[model samples]
Target chain A: MASLIACPHCGPRPKEEFTVRGDAGITRPAPDAGEDAWYAYVYLRDNPRGRHREHWHHTSGCRRWLVVERDTMTHTIYTVADASAEGETA
Target chain B: MADFALLHRPALADAKSGSFGAPSTVKRITLAALPEGHVLHVLAARGSGDLQGLIPRIGDGTPHAARPYGPGQWFVIGDAPLSSAEIFGKTPILDGKASISDQGHGRVRIGINGAAVETVLAKGTAVDLALSNFPVGHSAMTLIGHISALLSRTGKESFELLVLRGFAESLWDELIQMSLEFGVDAHTGK
Candidate 1:
């Protein structure tokens, strides 16, 4: 149960409206990068047990994509931000 | 409507006189189709134009509610369909590069009334519907079941919901089911 996530626009709502978009910190490999880089970028992932940053889509409401920082094990959402403009509001 | 022989049928074509519970029950929740209205999805963001000028204040001295479901975005609803270009004809905004999309036919609006309306809504949505919290003229985007729904409180005991055209029937069914525990009075017309 993902409880509630506060959407900067619609306020706190049930998480059902969102579809987790996965880790937000990963950078895509360069187009010219070798196969090893592409392999790592596409296959490798750090399953951090503690604090994690991920992207979530508010599919049902504002349709705004957001980045959420949370404690993986505790499922405590520390903060959120607009995915399109990470430096701005959550 | 992209060319086939589109059937002019209402979503709930077979709702029948199927109503559950009695009007004398604890509280009555009435669900019905709202009078036809126009909806505009306004994307008036950081670089967008001043949307405040588009939706004017009504006779009550209160401005018509612009539902801001996203940051810097609003959905302006009116009794008659009003397109952005039609409303703003020759005038153009230099500041706000606001984008407006007409959702007149792509969305469905339903009205929920009666004293038990709040109770029925509370069963699915998390927003506080208390009179002090979500009073009349208040509107917010929230989910009812898995569907994204824009809830606007029209009165103390009445609310209107806007959802995608495809999900109207499902949402309507869900609302009726939720109202079952309480009391639901269904009718074909207002």
Candidate 2:
């Protein structure tokens, strides 16, 4: 796990200050999109090995949702940006 | 009718007080519970830009009065309590750019100062307390040993922590424990 996350607003803080909301790349399916799509959206997730973008909430710091792009296998954080800045919802 | 009257009490009133830890003349820490005053949370409306100039009007004009913790968010604090009407009165100052939520009863402040204040505080938090990195008057909202508090540097050797009222006493005790190595004088009296 990435030990430190450089929050866009609060600077670099320990990972304990954040709450991971998982896969930021997934989009919510429409209400009438049918069962398979809704089920996949609700339950299915990609267990990617490297370079993942996820929604992380700065729970104890700025209280802002951030999109953290990092390597799952190496734990190297590539970039962290405010979720709202990219119009990305958590 | 209920016989119990709601008695207001400062959060740290019953917390630990007096000196403790090593007897050191060169590096001792002073810890005190600050006045239970006003704690107003200001949130900017969506698309509001550069509130830096407009937010201070709600503060008491003191140093670090407007402490920004995040984008479009600030905590306007003072040593004086404000009434509901008084708080609402300041709404117009933002000119519909922001809104204020009174948190006076929900949060408490703690003052800590000493020659080794930064060293003592670093034991719990991961923030870089160096003066060069966290200059005086800067504020950060972070966890100090699992407790979320707003840490603000008031001077080179002093800081003020704004914490939730319920956790005020607990954090005070933890602070005392952290400062034990340098000798601490905890004052909870109003």
lDDT (CA) per prediction:
0.73, 0.94
Off by over 4 Å in 1: A88-90, B1-8, B16-18, B23-26, B49-65, B81-96
DockQ value of candidate 2 = 0.94
Q: Please give the DockQ score of every candidate, comma-separated.
A: 0.74, 0.94
Error of 1 at B41 (Å): 1.6
Consecutive 10-residue window with the lowest summed lDDT within model 1 chain B: B55-64
lDDT (10s digit) by residue, model 2, range A1-90: 999999989899999999999999999988999999999999999999999999999999999999999999999999999998887553
For model 2, which pairs clash? none
**lDDT tens string, model 1, A1-90?**
357898876678788888897888888777999999899878887989989988898887778899988888998988887787776432
lDDT of 2 by residue, B96-172 (tens): 99999999999999999999999999998999999999999999999989899999999999999999999999999
lDDT of 2 at B136: 96
Residue A34 error, candidate 2, Å:
1.9
